[model samples]
Target: MVISVKLLEGKKVAQALDETMAKRVESLKEKGITPGLAVVLVGDNSASAVYVRNKQRRAEKLGINFQLIRFEESVTEQELLAKIDELNNDSAIDGFLVQLPLPDHIDEDKVNEAISPNKDVDGFTPISVGNLWIGTPMTKPATASGILMMLDHYNVDLDGKNVVIIGRSNIVGKPTAALMLERNATVTITHSHTKNLKEITSKADVLVVAIGRAKFITQDYVKDQAIVIDVGMDRDENGKLCGDVDFDDVKDKTSMITPVPGGVGPMTITALVDQVIELAEGRING
Candidate 1:
């Protein structure tokens, strides 16, 4: 039985979403508003740089007023918090995010909490997370939201499906579980310490992997005809980009799967900019 596999190409989905979002930006402009978004980057993390670049390009292409604030690695915690306060009150900027993995001297949670819940476009704040679980999200974490958006674009109904997410991070795993639950799917979240991981995964109708381990999940862990969404952005042994699930090793057995570079990566930025646009829309509604 040679099962045909469908690739959940997030790049294509992002392009399709961009068309509608761009029009929304244009409409806001006609009403004397241009959606504004900003990112604050500290130090020089290569991966963070790439993520920020992708976001800037997309936001600008949609006619959003994009801002990038750079801070030195030696900057004090108080200074960073002060900047956050400024952006929180900035009327022109609808939403903004501080790039994560900040230097050891800075407290990440403290910074995230400082961003106003309304402008917490990355949805990392406690207020945002609480709201999400309660079914009234102010904004969603970009990567998790993107995953659902891609699934919806493909018309993969989550209702009554068993979703096994192989990560428990606040960013992806927890939020994904919350969103899937709202759609009436039964969700299970597993992490590095999960015992009998394969046993749990092999029973899922849908599997989402975001453990940051290159090619960690293979066909052995997947159920026949299951849908897989890989969120890993790790380098393989040969220094090539690859996902948590080994595409070649698992694709033949799965009904649908996402590729390493063209999958969840692009959709993340699409979801980020979409959140910014929504906040901008609110400005007009009030």
Candidate 2:
């Protein structure tokens, strides 16, 4: 039996979300409120720069205010913390985040902690993470929320489903598990040390791969007709962009799968901008 594989393209999902977000932004404008978002980028990481640019474009396109704060690689930890304090009190800013992988001198934890929970749109603060697991999320980690948003867009029901997540990082794997568990799905998280990895992954109704290695999850790791979400942004042996799942080798076996570049990437910024707008909406309703 030949099964037609459906592509869960995140760009398409993001575009659909943009239309609604634009209307919401316009409504807030009519109420004299503008959704404001800021991103603090430290050092000169090319990948981080690209991610921040994409975010700026998306936020401005949706009519939300976007701010980019750049700091030199040599900036001290205290200097970064001072800026975080300023943004924390900046009424014009609704939500903000400091890009990860700060230089060796700065403490990433100290920076994340400095951002007030109310303005932690990146959802990395302890308070935000605590809220998410308890099912009263103030702001969700964008990538995990993006994955959930995509599944919801495709009408893939999660209740009582079995979900297996590859990688255990705070950004994707663990948070994705928390959100999926909230939907009543049984969640399992695996890392490099797990024994019989394929046996574990093959049983999942939905599989999410965020492991950094390129093409780590090939056809054998996936079960027939399982919904696969790949969160990896990696370069293949040929120096081209690819995902953790080998798309060519695994696409035919899946019912719905997200492509490498177009899949989980776009939804992330969408979720972030949406969170800022949601917070702005709160300003008036309260």
Candidate 3:
């Protein structure tokens, strides 16, 4: 007998988040403290450009102040850092993000560390990362937070569950593991270097794939009735969006799963907006 997987609709969750954020933004506006986001994009990665553009457009729609700073690929590390410094001192900018996948010559860690944690809305700084582990108030990396938000929205409880995440990247895997641990889930993190990845993933009650490879996780990697969340968004040979998990093959085996395009991606931006509103309200009035 084949089982049909329940779709975890991130678009629906994101809309709810937007409604909450919109009201918060309006409240801030009424108090004369307009929440703002400053985005700095280095180089011309097509995908990054599109993401930044969407963020700016959404910020405007919510009546939040938005700024986008574009720099050439040849821009020096010091030049980028200088721009971050300027935004850091600007009182009007409530949150700021330095877009990722920076140029090879630039030290991404240095740039991330340089941003003031108060305005580091991307949540890449060590301070924010530490706060997340400690359950303190800090902006979390939006993608990681989005995953948790989606799980909660679907009424999936993580406590005491065996949650296995594929990938060890700072942006998604490591932070997400920390979040699951905070939720009392026994979390296991695997990477390319891990031997017999399937054995580990098959034991999970919840499986999150963020390895960035298209359709890397198939039905064989999942346990029956496992909750699957795919964080990878890559175009397959057919030019359609595909995720790390083979949706068609694994969906039947899972209890719930997030789709490639409409899942984690949309929720991430919504999470960012939510955090920005929280930050603005906390700093200005709380």
Candidate 4:
């Protein structure tokens, strides 16, 4: 039986999230407690810069307090930590994030650990990671949270399903697997060193690909009627945005799938803003 994959468009999902955020922000504004997000960008990776800029623009359009801080590649690690310290103590800054893929000399883990958990809206801190594992009300990594939101939006039942997540990165793969487990899905995590990857993926009721490679998963790796979630964004040979899975090849074999560029990307940002608002509200009431 040939299955036609239903497209899970992220733009639509993101718009819905933004609308909800707008209403929540209005409520906060009326209460005279505006939620603020501070984004710190180190070095000048063109892609990272563009992402930060887009985030700032979106935050402004939504009337959320947004601040962007840029630093040169030569900036010292201590300097970056100091800035984070300042944000941590600043009551006006509800949440903040330090952009990823920092320079070689800087320890990413150290920086992530330095951010105060309450202000760590990026959800990269150890405390936040622990909260996610314990199923507490803490900010989760936006990408992981977005994937969960997408599943909920589509009404995908996760109870007792077999979920196979490719890649074991902390940002997306591992946290997502934990979340799936939380929803009662039997989760399996695969990485580069895993054996018989195709065999594992073929058994999955839900397949999430985040290996960060271009068009890596083909038709053979997917099960018939499996829900495929592509979390990778890569530029193809023609400079078109493509996902980790070969969309054309796998579309007809899956029950539903998320499209690249328009799928997981937008939802990630939306989830970040959502968490920020949630944090602000919780802080005020608690």
Model number with the top lDDT: 1
| Poorly placed runs, candidate 3 (over 4 Å) | 1-4
Give the per-residue lDDT digits (tens) of candidate 2, residues 1-286.
Answer: 7679999999999999999999999999999999899999998999999989999999999999999999999999999999999999998899999998899888788888888999999899999999999999999999999999999999999999999999999988888999999999999999989999999999999999999999989889999999999999999999999999999999999999999899999999889999999999989866
The CA lDDT at 21 in model 3 is: 81
- Using lDDT as the measure, name the better of candidate 2 and candidate 3: 2
All candidates: TM-score:
0.97, 0.97, 0.94, 0.95
Per-residue lDDT of 124 in model 3: 84
lDDT of 4 by residue, 1-286 (tens): 5445689988899898788889899999999888899999998999999889888877877778998989999999999999999999988888999998899999999999999998888887889899889988478888988999998999999999999999999889989987889999999999999989999999999999999889999999999989999999998889888999999999888998999979999988888888888877876786
Could you tell me which residue pairs clash in candidate 1? none
Kindly indicate the candidate among 1 and 3 with the higher lDDT: 1
| Candidate 1 off by > 4 Å | none
As a TM-score, model 4 comes out at: 0.95
lDDT ranking, best first: 1, 2, 4, 3
What TM-score does structure 3 among the candidates reach? 0.94
- Candidates in order have lDDT scores of 0.95, 0.94, 0.90, 0.90
Better candidate by TM-score, 1 or 3 = 1
Candidate 3: RMSD over Cα atoms? 1.8
Which has the higher lDDT value, candidate number 1 or candidate number 2? 1
Question: What's the count of clashing pairs in each model shown?
Answer: 0, 0, 0, 0
